[model samples]
Target: MPFTIKCPLDNLYGMHVFSRLPLHEAKVRYLVEEKVPSMHAMIELRSGEKVRIHFVHPAPPSPTENDESTERDAELVIVARSVADSDEPVIVTGDLNDVAWSPTTRLFRKISGLLDPRVGRGFYSTFHADYRLLRWPLDHLFHSHHFTLTSITRLPSIGSDHFPLLTRVVFAPSQGQDQEPLRPDGDDRSWAQDIAQSKNANKQDVP
Candidate 1:
């Protein structure tokens, strides 16, 4: 299965790219050239698959004359719903411009219920390799718990400031097919009051 997808970050350097291979089994391809809105797509091997995709970005606060400007890229969210009785796999890969440890990214991982293969796996710097201390891992591949991580690798820079990441993930039969709780229910009113008190305390602490 082959299809074309427009790049969300048009004219930006170091976006993801794809090519066909002859040795592969079944494959669904994505093309990221001159695309828009930073697409998120899922291809079902057959029918009755639950795959959800979302492209996201955080808009910066309004800039002032004294502030520096920056461009924020979109974060792709791909959800692969399990087949009813089949053991086929689902995979999602992309360049998420956000940092791995950012709160927004964490929330995304939680909401999407996707497990990052890079976690517990060693960190490999991908962005700003030239700057030793300032580099960070920006690209990511996240999968559901049903998927087992074979390998995750950071590749050499392709003439771009950010190097690419290649990951091999496989879907395995679930030992126990059960959904985990998303989050515990909390009192919104109490939480708001707590936040307000904390803010006032911080104000008192400030010089």
Candidate 2:
């Protein structure tokens, strides 16, 4: 007997998958190219509120000598710019392969205007399941100001390198007005653009 995996919700609602890289069946079996893959979706809630969700698994830091900018950082710059250009609420979640307090993540927050729930909270490390002290927070869930955290938990591991993050947020557009979004200064904007257009930046064909 043979079996196939499917997403019931996506199948029922006809959700589309968008990516910069081709699927596994395409010429590229995996993301061996410079660019990593980003999957995004626009979802409508029962209250008719539209939200954009972006998932990314960016490349980790390599030993190769490159510029100050990294592919992961460049991809983040792209995500930030896209979020800044959109009016709808957005949530970016994934194994970013970087720490929550790193310069890249801070720059990302500034450029995207997205908030991390972990602010004022503890560092919920998610990686290195095998070692106790070697763990660090790698997986993340960032949301726009339109939402507030109702609950967040670091779920038990199911035999993976990283632990799963479970977060519940309540949509409150009114709250967004009170929440001050992070804005990038002139220097910050220049840095982001430099990273995005860096010579070694990933140049995948994303639609």
Candidate 3:
């Protein structure tokens, strides 16, 4: 099934990109409301298997009105939950609003247990067609443990300023043995407290 993801707030005049992917029809899915500029959903195969689709985005951070760090952390929560507790395969695709090399993206990947197909695949910038030096990757498609990446490509620049990314991924067969259940870092109070503290500090300095 072919699907497209675009940031609703992005304009043709702005440096934003749209990501698209074509999946097999055998995958089952239930469309979810766009929680953020991005969206999330559930995907399943004909064998009654299920996977999760997580789209990443948040109301754009206003430098004049909001703390960028806090805004990013808030977005991280949504992205973290999309794959935090799933045993099934996951496909997270969209305009992340952050560059691939950003520290926040690295932390998110580690916390969510997701893998970036673009790593070691060469740097492919997807933003700012008007400024060559300002371009960076804002669009991405990340996968989970249950899937193996086949190929990834950046398509020609579309109407948006950013180039889209297309990734092909296949589900790996299960060993059928009892495995350890997947769980989130809910008990990790230290990290959660640190994030909370950082957000609060940023908010306090805003005024």
What is the alpha-carbon lDDT for the whole of candidate 2? 0.70
Candidate 3 has what TM-score? 0.66
Worst 10-residue stretch by lDDT in candidate 2?
24-33
Residue-level lDDT tens digits of model 1 in 109-146: 55445667777678776888677789887766765556
Query: Model 2 over residues 1-207: C-alpha lDDT tens digits?
Result: 121212223221122243432222212111222334456655566576667777666667756523343767887777777777777788888888789999899998998899998888878899997788899998899999889989888889889878878888888978766776667899999898888777344334221
Clashes of 3: 1
Q: Show where candidate 3 strays beyond 4 Å.
A: 1-37, 46-48, 60-65, 173-189, 196-207
lDDT of 2 at 2: 22
Clashing pairs in 1: 6-35, 7-35, 8-38, 50-81
The C-alpha local distance difference test score for the whole of candidate 3 amounts to 0.56
TM-score of each: 0.56, 0.78, 0.66
The total number of steric clashes, by the backbone 3 Å criterion, in model 1 comes to 4
**How do all the candidates rank in terms of TM-score, highest first?**
2, 3, 1
TM-score of 1: 0.56
Note the Cα lDDT for every prediction shown. Answer: 0.44, 0.70, 0.56
